[model samples]
Target chain A: MGKLYVIGIGPGSIENMTLRAKEAIEKSDIIVGYTKYVDLIKTLAKGKEIFSTGMKGEEERCKEALRLSKDNIVSIISTGDAGIYGMAGLILELKDGEDVEVIPGITASSAAASVLGAPIMHDNCNISLSDLMTPYELIKKRIEMAAEGDFVISLYNPKSKGRPHYLRESLETIKKYRAGNTPVAVVKHALRDGQDVKLFNLDSFDDSQVDMMCIVIIGNSQSYIKQGEFITPRGYKL
Target chain B: MGKLYVIGIGPGSIENMTLRAKEAIEKSDIIVGYTKYVDLIKTLAKGKEIFSTGMKGEEERCKEALRLSKDNIVSIISTGDAGIYGMAGLILELKDGEDVEVIPGITASSAAASVLGAPIMHDNCNISLSDLMTPYELIKKRIEMAAEGDFVISLYNPKSKGRPHYLRESLETIKKYRAGNTPVAVVKHALRDGQDVKLFNLDSFDDSQVDMMCIVIIGNSQSYIKQGEFITPRGYKL
Candidate 1:
C-alpha cells in the first residue's frame, strides 16, 4: 500500500507553503486537487501525473486520490490548510485501506491576518458565509454569538457570484451586537497574485468589494486601526 | 535603515516553517525571540547572532529587535503564526523608524487540526486560558459565547501547573451547550520533539492531561469520530 498525503499549499503562494507540504508534493507520484489548486503547484507537479476537477467536484477528487493511493504515493492538495474546508476529512472518510498523512499548511485566515496586521491577536472565530453545506440560519446564529462574545470574526467564502447578500447579512447581524465603528478588512487573494487589502468600519463597509476569493475580517470591540493598520492588541499595556 | 522580519516559525518544526520565513532568517544579521522559540529555530540561526530572553520578556525582545533593525537586518521569531499571540503586534507597536515585515506561519490550531482530523473544517474559535494578559471574566465570556455559537473551540494555553482549573472550567461551560459526546483532542508539541496527541469525549476528558504547551480542540455537535480520527465535516451532506 502506498501513502496518501493531504497537503495544504497555503494561500496560493509557493513561498507560504511549508517544507513538509513541499516535500510531500515533490515526492508524490500523483498530485490531485481542484483545477485551480493544482495550477498553483504546477512547478512542483512537474514530472508527476496530475489529476484535477472543477469546483464542487470534491467528492470525485477525493475518491480518485484514494484509488490512486492504493498503489502509488498520491498527494491531494487544498488551497489553504487541508484540514480546514480542505480534503482531509473527505479523504479520511473514503480511504479504506491506505495510509494517510495530513501535512498542515498556513490557513487563509492566518495569511489574511498577516496582511491585515494583528487583527486576530486575541480570541477569534471563523465563519463561512457560503450556504452550500450549512444552513443560513445556523450561520447567522453563529455570527450573532461570535459578535456577542466580542470575538474577532473571519468570514470565509463571504461572497460569491450566486450569493450576494450573505456578506451584507452577516455584517448586519454583527452590527446588532458590535458597534458600528468596529474595524473590518477585506483581503482579496491574500499572499497570491493580485493581492488587495482594504480597511473599513462596520458602517462604511461595502459588501460589493468582496468576492469568493476574499477573506473578510471583522474586528472585536477592542480592535483598532492604527496608522492604517488593523490591530487587536494581545492585552498588552502600551 | 535595515529591515526587520517578524517571522512565525510554525509549530516548533523546521519542516513546518515556510520558505519565506526561512529565507528571512537566513538573510538576517540577528535573530531575536523568546528563549524557547529561539531554540526551535537553532538550526537556521547557525553562526548567527541570537538574542533570546525568558518568557514575559516580549516587550524587551521587541525593543531589542527594533534597535538592531536600525543597523542590521533582524528576524524576530515566534512559535506558530507571528500574528497569533506571537511577536508581530509587539514588533509593529515598538517599531518607530524601522521597516518591519511580518511573515505568517502555521498556527497551532491548524497544526493540531491536521493531527486530529478536520475539526476546524467550518467555523471555529480560539481562546487562550492564560490570565496574565486577559481578564478571567472576559475569557469566560468568550468561552461561553463560542460554545453557544457551536464554534469548534481551540484552547491555547489551556492549562499550566499554576492554573490547573481553567481547562476544567472551560469544558464544564462548553458542556452546557454541547453534548457530552462531543469529541475533543489535545495536541502537545505538535510536529516537534515529544509530540503527543490524545483523543477524548467531552465527558471523558481529563484536564490533568493538558498543559500550557497543549492545544485542546473541542469539536462542535456536528463533528464525529470515524476510524479514530475526529472529523467535523464541511456540512457537505447536511
Candidate 2:
C-alpha cells in the first residue's frame, strides 16, 4: 500500500527537473538511483534515506526500490525522459500492485539535436551502438536500414572506456548506405554547464574523440551543413 | 553585428524554459512570438519592445525579429522545440549573415508521449496532420504509409473550426491498415495548467472532441491500453 514515482531528471542539471518532479522527490521518503545520480542531487537528499548502487545494478536497484516502497514513498530517477532508454521498462517489469507514476523530463537526444540546429528535422531515427546485450549484427542491420531509410541517426552509447571502437565499427557499417561526406554532430554534456558541440564530416571525424557521455547525430544524404548547422529536411515543399 | 536567438520554450511552462533560453530572453532587446505565446511570458517582456502576430504570420514575425537583430539582441519564441515543426525552418529561410543561435526546448509530442506512457517507445514515428497549405491527399498518403509501416502516428492540428472533420477522415484512412481497437490518446494543453487527457479506441473516438490545441497519438499494433495508460514496447528484452 505504497506509491512509487519514476522520474526523468533531464540530462544532468538540477534546474532541468520539472516542478512536479521536484515536488515528487521532495515528498518521497526514500530516493533510489545510481551512485553518481544520487551524488549529483546530494542537496535534495537532506533528510531522506538514499539508496545508491553502481552501474549494471539496475535490476537490483528496481527490486530494492519496490521492496522499500511497500511502506514509504519512493522515487527512481532516470537521466533523460524516463520512457525512452530509461528505467520505465525495468520498473514495469517489476511492478507488483504498486501505485506508480512517470514524470517525463527533457530527453538528451532531442535537446542535443536542438542545440545542433535541427539535425532531426524530419524522417529521422535513433540507434544506440552499445551492443551490450543486442548483437553487433543486429545493430549493423538497423544502421543499414536507418541509412537506407534516410533517417538522421542519433547514436547513443557511441563509445565507452572498455569498448572504445564501437563507434568506428558502427560508422563502417553505415558507410555502405551513407556517403562519407555526410554531416555528423557530437554534443557532449548537453545542458550541463560545460556543454561542447562539434560538427564533423563522416569522412574526417576521428573515432578516438568520442566518449560515452556524448550523443552523435549522423545526417542522411540530403542532410546538409550550412554555416555550421546540421539540417535534415522533412521533405516538405514549403 | 547583433545576435539573434531562436529559443524553444518547451511545452507550456516557465519552468520548461531552459536556463539558456531565460538568459537569452532576459538579455534580448526585443521579443517576437505568436500572440498566445507572447501572452504566456509577458513578465519576461517587462521593458522590451514586443512584436506579436497571429498564425500564418510566422514569416512576418521572423522577418521583423531578424531585422531588429541587425542592431539589437532579438529572439523569436517557438512554443515547443523550435526545430520540430517550429520556427527553425522559417528562420533558416530568412538567415542573412546574422548570427542565429538555436536554443532547443522540449517538444510537445515528446511531452504528450511521456504523459501517455510511451506510445512512441521503440520503433515509432510521428507526422503532423495539419495541411493548411499542403493538399489533404498528400497528408492522407502519409497517414496510409504510417499505418502500413505500423508507426505510432502523432497528429498535430487535427481539428479546428474549418477543418473539424479532418481527424475523422484521417481515422477512416488509418482503418485500412489498423484495427478498430487500436489505442488512441488525445492530449489537450499538454504540460499546461489545464491539461486534459482522454483515451479512446480508434473506432470509438468522437471527432468533435478534438481541437487545434490537442495532439492525438495513434498507437501501432503493439500498443495497448492498460489501466488507462498507453504502453508501447521499445524492444527492450527482459
Candidate 3:
C-alpha cells in the first residue's frame, strides 16, 4: 500500500513551507490540490504528475488523491494549515485504507497575527463565514458567544462577491456584545506577495475592504492599538 | 536604533522552523528565550550571545531582550507560534520605541491537530487552562461557552504539577454540554523528540496523561474516531 501526505504549504509562500512539507512534496510521485494551490507550488511539481481541481471540487479531489495513493505516493496540498479549513478531514473521511500523514503548516490566523501585531496573544476563536458547509445561524451564535466571552476572533472566508453581507452581519452581531472601539485588523495575502494589513475600530471597519482571501481579526475587550499596531494582552499583570 | 525579532521556532524542531524564522535568528546578535526554548535552538545560537531564563521569568526575559535590542539585533524566540500564548504580546507591550517584528510559526494547536488527525477542521476555540495570569472563573466560562457552541476546542497548558485538576475540571465542564463519547485527543511534545498522541472519549479520558507540555483537543458533536484516528467532519454532504 502506498502512503499519502496531506501537507499545508503555509500561506502560499515557499519560504513559509516547513521542511517536512517541502520534503513530502519532493518525495511524492503524484501532487494533488486545488488549482490555485497547485500553481502556488508549481515550481516544485516539475517532475510529478499533477492532479489539479477547481474550487468546490474538494470531494472529488480527495477521492482522486485516495485512488492515486493506492499504488503511488501522493502529496495533497492545502494553502494554510491542512487541519484548519483544509483538506485533511475530507481526505481522512474518504480514505478507505491508505496510510495518511498530515504535516501542519503556519495557518493564516497566526500569519495574520504576526503581520498585524499580536492580536491573538490570549484565548481566541476562529470562525469561517462561508455558509457552504455550516449554517449561518450557527455561525452567528458562535460569533456572539466569542464576543461575549471576550475572545479574540479570527474570521475566515469572511466575504465573497456572492456573500457580501455576511461579514457586515457578523460584525453587527459582535458589536451587539463588544464595544465599538474594539480594535480590528484585516490582513490580505499575509506572508505572500502584495501583502496588505489594515487596522480599524469596530465602529469604523469597512466591509468593502475584505474578501475571501482576507483574514479579519477582532480584538477582545482588553486589546489595544499602540503605535499603529493592534495587540491583545495575554492577561499578564505588568 | 536596533531591531528586535520575536520568532516562534515551531514546536522545537529545526525542520518545523520557517526559513524566515531561521534567517531572523541567524541575523541576530543576541538570542533570548525561555531556557528550554533557547536550548531547542542552541545549535543555531552557537556564537551569538544567548540569554535564557527559567519558567515564570518571562517578564525579565522580555525586558532583557528589549534592553539588548537597544544596541543589537535581537531574536527573542518562543516555542510554537509567538502570537499565541507566546512572548510577542509581552514584548509589544513593553516596547518603548524599539523596531520590533513578529515572525509567525506553526502553533501547537495546528501541530497537535496534525498529529491526532483533523480534529480542528472547522470553527474552533483555543483556551488555556493555566490560571497564572487569567482568572479561573474566566477560563471556566470560556470552556463552558466553547462546549455549548459545539466548537472544536484546544486546551493549552492543560495541566501541570502545580495545577493537576484544571484539565479534569475543564473536561467535566465540557461534559455538562457535550456527549460523553465526544472524541478527545492529547498531543504532547508535538513534532519534538519525545512526541506522544493519545485519543479518548470524553468520559474515558485520563487526566494523568496530560501536563504543561500537552495540548488537549476536544472534538465537536460531529467528531468521531475511526481506526484510532480522531476526526471532525467539515459538515460536508459526504
Candidate 4:
C-alpha cells in the first residue's frame, strides 16, 4: 500500500512551507485540497492529478485522498499546522490507515502569536469559536473555564460575514470571566493575502475590523500589551 | 535600517523548515543562535557570518543580534517556532526598532503532539518543567490547576541528569488530579537524531524513560490510549 502524507502548508505562502511539505508536494502522485488551495499548488504540481472541492467539503476531499493513497502517493494540504483546525481531526476520524503520517506545520495561531507578540507565553489554551459543527454552548463553557483558570487563550474562527456577529458575543462571554482590559488581537489572514494584525483591548475593540479568516488571541488576566505587543509572561524569567 | 527577521525553523529536521525560513536564512548577512542551532542553518548559510554562543547565554546573544541588525541584515534562529519557547520573546524585550518581522515555524510540542496522536487538541495547555528559572512550587500549582481544568498537558524539560527526579515528582503531582490510566507519551529528540516516541500511561511509567530533550505530554481525564495512539479529543466533533 502506498503512503499518505497529510501536510500543513503554513498559511497559504510558499515561503512558509517546510522542506518536507515541499518535497511531499513535489513527490505526491495526487494532491487533494480545496479548489483555492489546489490553485495555490498549481505551479509546484505539474503533470499530477489534482482533486479540488469547495469550502466545508473537506470530508469528501479526504476520502478521495485516501482512495488514491491506496494505489499511489497522496497528500492532503491544510493551511497552517495540519492538526490544529486542519484536516488532521477529520482524517483521524476516518482512521483511513495506520500508514498516515501527519506532518505538522506552523499553526496560524502560532504564526499570529509570533507576529502579535507573547500573549500566549505562560499557561495558554487554544479554542475555536466557529461552532460550525461544535455547539456554541460548549465553546462558551470552555472559554469560561480557560478564563477562570487564567489561561492565555487563542481564538480561532472568531468572525465571518454570513457568520459575522460571533466575535462580539464571544468577547462578551470572555469579558464575563476576564477583565475588560484583557489584551485582544485580531490577526487577520495571517501570512496570507490581506494580512493585517491589530492589537487592542477587548473593551476597546472596533467591531468593524475583523472577518472569518482572522485568528483572535485573548490574554489571561496576567496578559498585558506592551508597546503594541501583547505579552503574557510565563512566570519564569532571568 | 535593515530588517530583522525572527524566523522559526520548526522542529529539528531540515525538512520541517519553511521556505520563508530558508529565504530569511539565505538573505541574512549575520545569523545569530546557539551553536547547535547555528549548525542547523550551516548548509543554507554559505556566505553568512554566523554568530553562535553556548546555552543559557541568550540575553547576550540577543543584544549582539540586535546590535548587528542596526547596520546589517540579521536573523535570529530558534529551533522550534521562534514564538513558542524560541528567541522571539527576548528580541521583543529589546524592541530595538519597528522593522522586525517574525516568521513562524513548527513548534516541537505540536509536532510531538501530532506524532502522539491527538494529545494536545483542545482544553489543553503547555508547561515546561525546566525549573532552571521557574520555581518548582509554581510548576506544581500550574499542574494542579491544569489537571483541575482537565488539560491535556505537554511538558518540556521533564528530566535532565541534573534533575533526574523531576519527572517522577511531576508524575506524582499529576496523579493527584489525573487518573492512573491517563495516557502519557515521552518523545525523545522528536524528529531529531535518536528520536524515539514512547507511549504509555501514568500507571505504567517510571523516571528512567525520560531525558531533558524529551517532551512529555500528559493527557487529561478525557484522554485515552487506543491503537498505540494517545488520544485527546478537542470535543469539537461532538
Candidate 5:
C-alpha cells in the first residue's frame, strides 16, 4: 500500500495552510475532502485525482481515500486541523494497516480567537454544539462543565438550521456560571470570504448574528475587553 | 505605524509553519521572540534584525516589539500558535495602537495529538500544569471539570522542576471521573528534534516520562486504541 496523508487545509485561506499540508498535496496522486473545503484548494492541487463530496458524505470520502491509497499516494484534506473535529479519526478508523500520516494545521479555535484579539490565551475548551451524532444532553453537560471550570470556551458549530437555538441554550448554561459582563465574540467564516466579526458581552450578544459557519468564543471570568479587542491575560502583571 | 506581525512558527518545524507566518517573517525588518523560539526561525529571517530573551522576558519583548513597530515592520514569534499560551495576548495588551496581525499556526496540543493518532478528535480541554502564572488549585479544578465533561484532556506544561507531581495529581482527579484504562499519549518535542511519542493506559503511564516540554493527552470516554494508535471517534457508525 502507498502512503496516505490526512491534511488540514486551514480555514479556506491559502495563507493559513501549513507548509506540510501544501507539500502533501503536491506529492499526492489523489486529493480528497468535503466538496466545499476541496473547492478552496482544488486550484492548487491541479493534475491530481480530485475526489470530493457534499456534507454528510464523510464516510464515503474516507472510504474512497482508503481505497485509492491501496496503490497510490493520496492526500485526504480537512478544513482546520484534521484531528480536531476533522477527518483524521474516521480515516484512521476505516483503514487498519495503511501507512497514514496526520499533518496538523491551524484549528478553527485559534483562527477565530486570533481575529477577536487573544481571547484564548489561557486554559480553554472547545465544544461543538452540533448534536448530529452526539446527544444533546451530553453536549449540554459538557458546556456546563466547561463553564464551571472557568475555561475560555470556544463553541463550534454554534448555529444550524436544524438547531438554531443551541447557541442560545449553551450560552444560558454558561451564563449561570459566568458573569453577564463576560466577553463574547461571534466570528463567521474566519479567514474566509464574507467574514464577519462582532464583539459583545454575555448578556448583550445578539444570537441572530451567528450561523452554522460561525464560531462563538466566551471569555473566562478574568477575560476583559481592551481597546475594542477581547483578551484573556496569561497571568501577566502588565 | 508599521505592521506588527505576531506569528506562530508551529511546533519548531519549518514545515509546520503556515504561509502567512513565513510571509510575515520575510517582510519583517525586526524579529523578536523567546530565545528558544527565535532560534528555531532565525535562519529564515537572516537579513532581519532579531531580538530574543530568556524565559520571563515576555513583557520586555512585547514592549520592544511595540516600540520597534512604530517605524519598522516587526515580527514577534512564538512556538506553536501564538494565540494559545503564546505572545499574542501580551502584545495586544501592551500596545495601545499598532497594526498588529496575529498569524495562527499549529498549536502544541494538535501537534502532539497528531503524533499520537487522533486522541483529541472530540471536544477537548487544554490546561497548563505550570503554576508560574496560574495557581495550582485552579489548574486542578480545571482538570476535574474537564474530566467531568468527558472531554479529551490535553495537559500542557505537564511537569517542571518545581512541580513534578502535578501531572500525577491532575491524573488522580481525572481518574476519579474516568476509567483507569483510559488511553493516554505522552509526546515530547513533537515535530522537533528528539521527538518522543508513547502510549499507555491512564493507570499505567509513568510520571517520570513527562516533563515541561511534554504534552499528555488523555482520551475521553468514547476514545480507544486501535492498531496501536489512540483515537476518539467522531460518532461514526463504522
Candidate 6:
C-alpha cells in the first residue's frame, strides 16, 4: 500500500537538485539506481536502505524497486530528467504504474547549454548514440533529419567502449547540413565535480575528448561562438 | 560591477526549483522578468526591487536587466529551463557575455512529461509554434523533420490568440508521419496550480484543449496508453 517515486536528481551536486527531488529521497524508505548515480546522491541517501546494480542491470534494478514499492516508499533515481533516456518508463512499465510519481529535474542538455551560453535557444532534438536498446541506423537517421531541419542537436551517451564508431558516424551525418564553422561543444560532467566544457567547430572538434560521461552539443546552422560562448539566436534580429 | 544570474524557475512552484535557482534569487538585489513569471516567485522577491514588463517586451526587459546589473546583482527569471526558447540567449546577446551565471531548471517539456507518465522516454524533439520571432515556414519545416525522424515531438506555445492556426497546421504535418492512434497528451500548467494532464489519440484530440500555457506531446509510432498513463517503451522486452 506504499507509493513509488522515480526521481531525477539532476547533475551530481546537492545544489543542482530540486527541492522536491531532495524531498522524495528523504521521504523514501529505500533508494535504487545505477551504482554511479547512487554514489552521486549518497549524501542525501545517508542511512537509507540502498540498492544498486552495474551498467546493464537496469531491468533488475527497476524490478527490485517495483517489488519494494509494493510494501514501502521506494525511490528509483535517474540522473537528469527521469523521463529523458532515464528509468521512468521502465518503472512505469514494470509496476502497472498504480502509485508512481515522477519528479522532474534539469536535464543534461540544459545544464550543458547553460555552461556553453545558450546553444539550444531555439527548437532542438536530443539523440543518444548508445546502440544498446536503440539501433544505430535509427539514431543515425535522427541525426540526419535533425541536421536537415536545422534543429539544435544534443548528443547523449555519445561514445563508449562498446560503441566506438557511432559518434563519428553520427557527426558525419550532421556535417552534410551544418557548416564547417558551426560551433560544437563537449560538456563533461556538467554541474558536477571536475566539470569540463570546451567549444570546437563542426569540422574540427576532437572526438577523443568525448566519452560515455560527456554530453555533446552541435549547434544548428545559425549557432555561433561569440565572446567564447556558444550561442544560438532565437530568430533574433542581430 | 554586479553579476547577472539568468535563472530558470522550473514549472511554477518553488518546490520544483533547483537549490541553485533559489540561492540565485536570494542573492539577487533585483529581479527582472515578464510580469507573470515574476509574479510566480514574488514571495522570494519580496522587499526586493522587482521590474517587470508585459508580453512582447522581451528586448526591453533584457536591456533593463543588463543596465541594472552594472551596479546591482540581477536575477532574470524564466519559468522553464532558461536556455530553451527562454531569456538566456537574449541576455547573452545584450551583454558582452561577461560575468553571467546561468542556473538551469526543469523545462516545461520535462515537467509535462512527468505529469503525463513517461510519454517521452526515448529520443525527442521540442518545437515551438510561435512565429513571432521565428518564421512560420521554418517552424513548420522542423515539425515535418521531427515527425519524419520518428521522434517523440513536444510542442510549446502551441496556440495563442494571434497564432490560432499554427497548432492545427503543425498537427497536420505530424499526422503525415505518425499514425492517427498514436498517443498524444496536453499538460496545462504542469506542476503548478490548475495543472491538468489529458491523453488522447492523435486523430481525436481536441485542439481547443490546448493554449499558449499548455505543452502538447505527440507520441512516436510505438507509443500507447496503459493504466490510463501515456507510456512509451524504451525498447524493453514487454
TM-score per candidate, in order? 0.98, 0.82, 0.97, 0.90, 0.98, 0.98
lDDT of candidate 2 over B1-238, digit per residue (tens): 7888988887768765666677788999999999999877778878899999998888889888888889999989988778777787667656778888887767777778767776765544455666665467756766665666565777877788877777888888788878899998999988777888999988888866788899998887767876677877555455
lDDT by residue for model 2 (A44-154), tens: 777899888998888888888888888999999878777766777667656777778777767777778767877776545556677666566766666665665555678
In model 6, the clashing pairs are none
Per-residue accuracy of model 1 over A1-238 as CA lDDT, tens digit each: 7889999999988899999999999999999999988888899999899999999999999998988998999999998899888888888777687889999998899999999888999888888888888888999899999988899999989898888988888889889988888999999999999999999999999987788999999998888888878888887787
- lDDT per residue (tens digit) for residues A1-238 in model 4: 7878888888877877788888988989988898887776678777988888999887788777877888888999888877766877666666645468888888878878977876566656777777666567766666666766566777877776766777787778778878889888889877777789988887897768776678888887777877788777654354
Worst 10 residues of 1 chain B by lDDT: B89-98
Question: lDDT by residue for model 5 over A36-141, one digit each (tens)?
Answer: 8888897788887889999999999999998889899999999999999999999989986788999998899999988988999999999999998899999999
How many clashes show up per model? 0, 0, 0, 1, 0, 0
Candidate 2 Cα deviation (angstroms), residue B75: 3.3
Query: What would the per-residue lDDT of candidate 6 be over residues B1-238, giving only the tens digit for each residue?
Result: 8989999999989999999999999999999999999999989999999999999888898899888888899999999999999999988887864478888989999999999889998999999998888889999889999999999999999999998888888888889988899998999999999998888887897888788999999999888888788888999886
Question: How far in Å is the alpha carbon of B8 misplaced in model 5?
Answer: 0.9
Q: Which residue pairs collide, candidate 4?
A: A15-B20
Instruction: Please list the residue runs of candidate 6 whose C-alpha ends up more than 4 Å from where it truly belongs after superposition.
Output: none
Candidate 3 residue pairs that clash: none
- What is the Cα-based lDDT of residue B188 in candidate 1? 94
Better of 1 and 3 by DockQ: 3
Candidate 3 local Cα displacement, residue A230, angstroms: 0.5
Clashing pairs in 2: none
Q: Give model 3's DockQ, 2 decimals.
A: 0.85
- Candidate with best lDDT: 3
Tens-place lDDT per residue, model 1, B1-238, is: 7999999999988899999999999999999998888888888999999999998988999899999999999999989999998888877666576888889999999989988878888789989999999889999999999999899999999988877888899999999999899999999998889989999999999877688889999999989899899998886651
